[model samples]
Target: MENNFKMVAKTLFGFEELLAKELKQLGAQAVTIGVRHVSFVGDKGFMYKANLGLRTAIKILKPIAKFKVINENDLYNKVNAIPWENYLKSDGSLAVGATLNGDTFTHSQYVSLKTKDAIVDRFRDQTGERPNVDLRFPDLKIDIHIDRHFCTVSLDSSGESLHKRGYKIATNIAPINEVLAAGLIMLSGWDGQSDFMDPMCGSGTVLIEAAMIACNIPPNLMRNEFGFERWGDWDVDLFEKIEESLLSKTRDFHHKIMGFDKSPSAVEKATQNVENAKLEDFIYIKHEDFFKTQKGGEEHLHMVFNPPYGERLDIEMETFYSSIGSTLKHKYPGTNAWMISSNLEALKHVGLRPSRKIKLFNAKLEARFSKYEMYAGTKKTHKLEAKND
Candidate 1:
């Protein structure tokens, strides 16, 4: 049998390219990008590596079965045929989830329930034993994706969402998701070459992720567990070797990675999170309002942050965004400033023209990530051309 198998990595919108690049760097083969996902071929070790290293992937799934279906019965029959015994024991537990674009399946929960029934019934009919359902920690997590009359059943090789990088225990009011934070940092093209800052550094997610990227630290090293750890063929020795090899490649990051938040509580939380990630030596956090701040030095500063999005309108968003624009233009010359916001109307108030803008999603709200280039000249008129007369 072929050790190489197909796997799909689900990602947020606009992160497909970043996820593909991450998979490619980690040695995945035949990588192809799909809408909100990327498929590739890799062995079990590669799967584990992807789980550990892919910064942009939300989850990794291994497709085991696919079939055409007319209705719920068809879905049930298709799910029942998969060899569940090979993946889990009769005493093992399972969780089932689904996505849909089919007429027969109106509710994802019902589809998930049907899929679970099929898996449990198969085991009961064969060995007279049924597995228990444990949604938190399942022996086999199954995914059902229905598009039209076609349904695909897959094993969730990633138990928890990959965003749970296991580094963050403390959080502020608006801590960014690990995957999204990493993706945003990578997209900013800050390759650990210069000083970095996250002004509204609630929980210091961006700072910690940036340090990890700068030092080449494996994101999942602190993870409590990986789904593949429960697999029968898990080779601890091989995994340890892989971990060691990756660790050996990690280089030291010398530049300062700093964070600033307005709230003292936020500063405390960010500092604690930084310590939890074992990165206190490389990162520094402080309590300060971003708008009132200026650059620490004359060096080029690379900043990536998610400022308050008027969640409660405590701060006048128009003034807040304008202050962000004013701070960059007046206080932060020689800096490349980037921010993401779900409040599109408020974003326009930041008058400095953006050099780049990308569409993204912050949870359920649509968001935009925009970049502003603040050149190192007083009353800077942006990057301009000399008049030739």
Candidate 2:
């Protein structure tokens, strides 16, 4: 209990509740939800579990200090006063990233530089040696967030965003981020109980995340490394035990998970990624236009995908979305179809009313995750529900 500390798991917008629930499920103490983040208390083992198991988190930060600062010098002095040796060795490398939400610190880069200088200076003064700044692969990654007059200094426990799940092969096809992909599936409320499909799957990120969720597999199990691995107090045995514990909880997924892409290159890439994730046994990929594809079985198919929003592709979005609605209404009966799009105007052209509209952000663009339910029963009932909606 004495070793426990407060940590914050950062997530995308509209996923606070999801992350909070995840934290609570993971046996975190004092789980509290904030805007785009959740704070909880846990020991080092729990921190490792979070970075490995959290599907919706982008990063996990363990705050070490919080103070009120009026200016840059005060910030530097407070940071310099901390015992840097306790976290990083004098000969180790470091990296600092900053985010500012208020007028007190308008420049994040300058603040990061200042904070880095303070830490190096502290080490130099104490031990006559200083840690080098290695931004690419730092031994210690620090995060500084200044919100209005309040400032937080935290040690980043998930190096390089947790979205880089390490299983994705580099490709030109821009897929949805892994963290966002997992969150979208969670928000859609799919538990891997029924058949799952990603109609417009680009790089198969949704399919992979869905399969992992269905089997209760840790999203970051395949990650190359985490920030805590390089920490001074890193315990290899403890981490392996946590990994084994998580693996033991994984359940078998009996339902089918599949994806379709019009582009052959996308199909190949998705297939390769699924293989890289070692989930080929669970996911099926095919090169077929989503518009022409039909739901295969009547096993309550659950669909989640991110369609092109006309930002990159030159296709007619209105017609594309109309085909989506048409396919769901005609061919994909008894399916709960959900898609995210930044183009609100194009979404209006889908022709079917969405049962639910969740406000979310895709990167910097504000988007909506819309749900359309196609009933298996009488057309009259489906139309009545649509009319009521």
Candidate 3:
């Protein structure tokens, strides 16, 4: 218990709660939620597990110190005074990133530069050799977050963002981010007990993430590297054991997972991504427009998709969105259809009041994840009645 330390898992906007839940389920203690962030207590082995397992998190930061600073010099001195040697060798490479949210610190780049100079200078003064700055492959990645007058110095434990799950080698126009896609699926509350789908499954990100969730596969199992791999106290054997334990929990998913896209190129790219993730047997992709498709069989269905938002003028945004509603209501029954779009006004054209509307950020654009329930036959016809009324 003494070895357990506080760590912050950063996530996309509106995914903090999902990340917190994931951490708690993964055995994280003292779980606390913040804006786009979750704080928890875990030991070294647990840290590796979190990195390997957490799907909603963007990065994991291990805080080393926290203090209030009035100016940039105070920040530099505070950062330099820390024992960098413990984390980075004199000959190793390093990178520093800073985020500013106060009037005093106007430029984030300048703050990062100052912090870098201090650390390199300390190494030069002591060992006559300073660590080189290697932004691409740093021995230690440092994070400086300044909120108001408060500054927190931390070590970035998840390098290159957790979204780079190492399975996506192909992408199409508007292919959704892996982390955002996973969070959306989790938020939609689709357990593996039912048939799952992503109608417009460009690059198969959502479909792959869905299969992983259904079978309890760690999101980052295909990732080439995790930030903790470079830590001074990395334990390879423990990480292997953790990996084995996580993989051991995998279960069979009996429901069908399907995908469709109007573009044949998109279908090809998505199929390639599916194969890359080694989930080809679990997912099926076809080149078909979502609006022209229909649900079959007596199975209940759960769907999550990102149709073209017309952000770059592919089609009439309103008409396209309306088509989404018409397709779901008339074709897909006994199903819960969820879609996300930054075009809120166009979403109004869907004409079906959402059962759940959640605010989420797709990259920098603010979007809404809204759900429309399609009942079997005239059953639960209230949605259509409400639409007509």
Candidate 4:
């Protein structure tokens, strides 16, 4: 238990609970949810597992020190006191990023620069050598979080954001973030129990994530690298053991996972991504206009997608959203459809009242994730109309 240390998994807004649930399911101890992040206690091997397995996490951080700082000099002193050699080599490259919440630090960039200077100064003073700064690919990635007078310095365990799962070499114009796609699927309550789909799937993110979730596949198994891989204490055998343990728990998913994109190019890219992920057997991608498609059978379908909300005009977007609503209403019965869009005005054109709506963000844009449940039969459709009437 002495080896167990606290770690934080950062996620998107509205995904804190999902990330916490993922950490708990992955055998984390003392899991607790915070704003856009989850704190958990785990050992080194468990930390590796958390980085590799969590679907909703954007990055995982291992806090090394937390102290109160009243000024920039105090910040430098606190950061410099930590043993930098323990995490990085004299010849290694490092990067520092900071997030400031209090008025004490008005500029996060300045804070990052100060932290970097402290680490480099320490190394230079002790060994006459210092790690160079490499923001793109660093041997050590440090994160500083300051809330009011409290400052927390942590080492980033996952690099390049967990959303870059390395399987998507090709993408559509507006491919959804892999983390957001997975979170949306989780929020939809789809556990690979029935047929799943992304009706407007672009580049197959949702499809691949669905397949991975259904089969218990570790999300970052295909990632090119993790920040810990470059650490001074990096252990290859321990990491391999954790990976094997995760692979051993993968369950078989029987239900079909399908994707539809109107654009042939998008479908091709999606298919390529699915193949890249080695999930082609579990996923099927088609270049068909979703508006024209109907439910293939009597089986219930679970759909999650993000429709286009780009530079199109209001009337066109309204028509598109209305078509989406109409397609689900008449053609796709016995289905639970979920969608996310930043265009609130266009969303009102959908006509059908959403059963549930949750506030979320699609990158920088504020968006709403809404669900529409269609009843099973023609009678239910008439009943729905009657209720609306």
On lDDT, the leading prediction is 2
lDDT of 1 by residue, 228-276 (tens): 7777777888888888877887998879999998889889988988999
Give the per-residue lDDT of model 4 (tens digit) for 91-202: 9999999999988898999999999999999999999999999999999999999999999999999988999999998987677999999999999999899999999888
Report lDDT (CA) for all predictions. 0.89, 0.93, 0.91, 0.92
Model 2 clash tally?
0
Model 3, residue 179: C-alpha shift (Å)? 0.9
Sorting all predicted structures by TM-score, with the top scorer first, yields 2, 3, 1, 4
The alpha-carbon lDDT assigned to residue 12 of candidate 3 equals 92
Better candidate number, 1 or 2, judged by TM-score: 2
lDDT of 2 by residue, 280-333 (tens): 999999999988877776689999999999888888888988999999898998
List candidate 1 stretches off by more than 4 Å: 378-389
Native-to-model Cα distance after best TM-score fit, residue 171 in candidate 2, in Å: 3.4
| CA deviation > 4 Å runs, candidate 2 | 377-379, 382-389
Q: State TM-scores per candidate.
A: 0.96, 0.97, 0.96, 0.95
Q: Determine which window of 10 residues in candidate 4 has minimal summed lDDT.
A: 310-319
RMSD of each: 2.1, 2.3, 2.9, 2.9
